[model samples]
Target: MNAFRTLATIVGGSLKNNATIECDDHGAEFFKVEINSSMDKAINHPDLTFLQGLSCRDSSSSTFGPLTLAQLSHFECGEVALSFCMLHKVGDACSAYYFLRDWARLTRDPKSTLSPPYFAMDSLMPSPFDGPMVSPVVEPKMEGCIHQRFIFSESKINALKVLVVAESCWLSGRIEKLPHLFPNSITMMVLSFSGLTEDPMPILEMLPNLRNLDLFRAYEGKEIISDNNFSQLEFLHLTELEKLKRWLLGTNVMPLIKGLGIHNCPNLKEIPQRMKDVELLKRNYNKW
Candidate 1:
């Protein structure tokens, strides 16, 4: 165990409530650090207590993404302090769990003898899925389409949260939309962790059984649905997405997407023929 790290392991069933990290883009990686000034006085704070009770694995990656350093620090103050770190999902899950556990053990008792966990990335990769890879066929469209982007305002976000909590608590709507609320920000988490009532708007229909999503670019800044299966998506949204190349990896998802649209995607260079072929609708692209 390394005394240099943060927090002690709260073993047994208690761990079930602790945040055990996971990522949708198992390929993506980030770490969180929380500092408690007094060795024995930080972990008992309400946020850490809530964090102790909440399951990190059960929470959405989007919500987990925006944990600020201050929040992390505040949660670890006043007894039972913690320094939390979440690694990417690209490698073994057990390795991450025990690594943190060992760190906690060391932090809790510096004299406790424990072998440190090793991280070797190369050894973790396995032979490919042992399946045939699909080929991509794309007929690019003209680049005259308008690209738009937008972000929900605080009021809009709060309103969404209220609607979601009401619906989740009421046991309404399909089970799928629940995951949409969990993003890096606390606000996103509030909205995502709750239920979404049915909306008369077409957007509700677009969210059916959808597992993964991205807000990279929209044609008119309107939310677009990409008709891809959530089950097989390896990557959801790529940063700085101006255009899509050949839809290669998750082609199997085409039929399962409940809703698919692209608007206000300013940099989206080429449009796929299949997407444009569908009955298309256009809406305003709100600015971020």
Candidate 2:
């Protein structure tokens, strides 16, 4: 019902499906989240960055493996910064976004009530290829498109009602003005707000020195900046972005990206027409 509750539902579902992971000691074990006070502390940490492999096409593939001490040292305590990790395209971007946001909200306020994640399992169609491997454990089927589902208790669900109501209240005005720009689903709308942006002005004003970027899809003509310039972006993400035709077509291309994600965007199955990578396409489609 509320944003925080919706997040609980997702986490509940993830736990049910055996898709969740947790670490207690900071960098004592690889799975634990590491924290620091400065970039120098992050650099000084002894953890090693490891390459993570994926078994699906969902956001699950994007999860960062145990960071090297150097990478861990990058995090600063008490400073909220956006961090990037790889996920599989099969992992629901909406579910992932709500899960984290709600988790944070619950951590801050424990009395939140959440609703169950809508499980359209019957709608998901089974895969055609039974190969040893194919990306995204779940793919869009021509017929029924089944997706995994999860839900939290009514008590937890209720606690998040206020936050969800607040977001709905905020979004109502925007939706009324631009009815056509409504997101494909609630999950997309939640992610569009939660993720970071490449805009330096907001980052500089809100954060200390503009380190992490919470990039996500901007609706058609959202006016991120009067002039489109994102040359210093370290992260780029596309989440359920159905209308990215103009953004990709723009001449201002990003050069130095440390992380990139294209998630839950059904409208963009193919790369832009102009910048298409022929060899990568061949490899992706296996047209040798």
Candidate 3:
């Protein structure tokens, strides 16, 4: 069988046992895909950004099933981005990860054994916790949302590390001569080219004049950006970030933020309660 055929067969066979799956009125959503050629230079570049995504968009390019669909995007650079849009109602990360792992094993060998699903989630969820909770019902309509994949090239990621470290920050202020304290010559920052293993917040702290920030699939960090970071940021766009759980904002961080777009952040639990008391946000009339 060809790649597509094999892929379809394997996915179909496994969906039968997909626990808590959401079936649309149209039945199984199967899969939808498109091949992209526009990002050849970015994807094939020696330095590349990390992977991200899965959004339910009204556009024909995106597939919004009851909530699960797999999309494989092939670029002219011979790079492929396989993204799965799965709603929390149907399945959470645990189920999705298991499904993917099983799919890989089956793709490698049809006879691979499967891990049993643990149905006793009540033990972990308890009683009151299982009660109704607030869900993400509001979807912000963003006309300025940048749809292109963000690329943080190898050299750029390295530059971030070198320029943003604690040692560099201290040395620049001291008698030690450093190359311009900070790379202030570059004001605008974009991180979409490469998958980043290190957190870019430290680097961002050094760029006080940074006004526009576009981050795509860059930080899978648990705690993103220390307090007081992004003090001078105005326009910020974060898309498809996976592991961010909390937004650490201080008294004066993002004080001048005019527009902030957050898209496809599944695990971002909540904003720090302390931010509510920040006088700067109230003075600037900024609503997060």
Candidate 4:
């Protein structure tokens, strides 16, 4: 119990804090911690339903805290289960992954160094109001929900891949002639070319209806420029762009983009200024 408490303290920031949102006021909500000790060796089983009881649940109140921690220890089987339930308003799945990773690292070695958490979302996307905030009402209902589990073994996955490859060959033929045949009809594109020395924007911009673009090691250039293209693009993902240093977007490019993701772009220095306030931006880099 002491070790878990120390672990929680090490993950200090918002996980340790409680927040409450009301109609016209914001206050501290309950940060509940529950510890359970059981002698039932069934907790050592791989059943999913048994794991659900290890976490805390508050069905009585519609509003709850941003974080909840539950620790379950089985004395007979000598197993410990630590569960965390964090609200999406506090952070997303990636945030939870990093939190758990850092906690594990600290658990192994308390002196290990970690990258500091970034908490400047308000500065990046500021709210206009300075007065009391109004919380949206959340009504919980489970009327017609059905849950089922599906398992795909390795052989099944390989069979599906065979089917996909047959379709992909036909799709590849269509994509090769896409610019001349169906530029306006194609709405999504994924390009990955080896040793591509020229800019791909000029060729891709012709597809006026393209809404999703994913470029993975497609261009081996220092810079990429887009000039008034991708008018209907809603999401863009760039991955493994090793040499991309600067990306420039025109005033009218990607006007409808809602999500932008950059991964393994070690040399990307900056993004377009117009995309600073996109609804979702997932960026991962070794340097910047």
- Tens-digit per-residue lDDT, 157-212, candidate 1: 99987775442212222343333342222111011212223211133223434333
- Name model 4 segments beyond 4 Å from true: 1-182, 281-288
TM-score rank, highest first? Answer: 4, 3, 1, 2
Per-residue alpha-carbon lDDT of candidate 4 for residues 66-150, written as tens digits (9 for 90 to 100): 2434333343345554445545545566766776677678778877777766655655455558522345334456778788999
Backbone collisions counted per model = 42, 51, 14, 0
Q: Which residue pairs in model 4 clash with each other?
A: none
Overall lDDT per candidate, in order of appearance: 0.36, 0.36, 0.52, 0.58
The superposed Cα distance between candidate 2 and the true structure at residue 239, in angstroms, equals 40
The alpha-carbon lDDT assigned to residue 274 of candidate 1 equals 44
TM-score of each: 0.24, 0.24, 0.32, 0.36
- What is candidate 3's lDDT per residue for 122-201, written digit by digit as tens? 54455455333334233445778778888899999998776664222221111211122556644576665335555666
| RMSD to truth, every model | 20.5, 23.2, 19.4, 16.4
Residue 230 lDDT in candidate 3: 74
Cα miss at 209, model 3 (Å)?
1.4
Candidate 1 vs. true structure, TM-score: 0.24
Greater-TM-score candidate between 1 and 2: 1
Give candidate 2 regions above 4 Å deviation: 1-31, 35-77, 80-90, 119-288
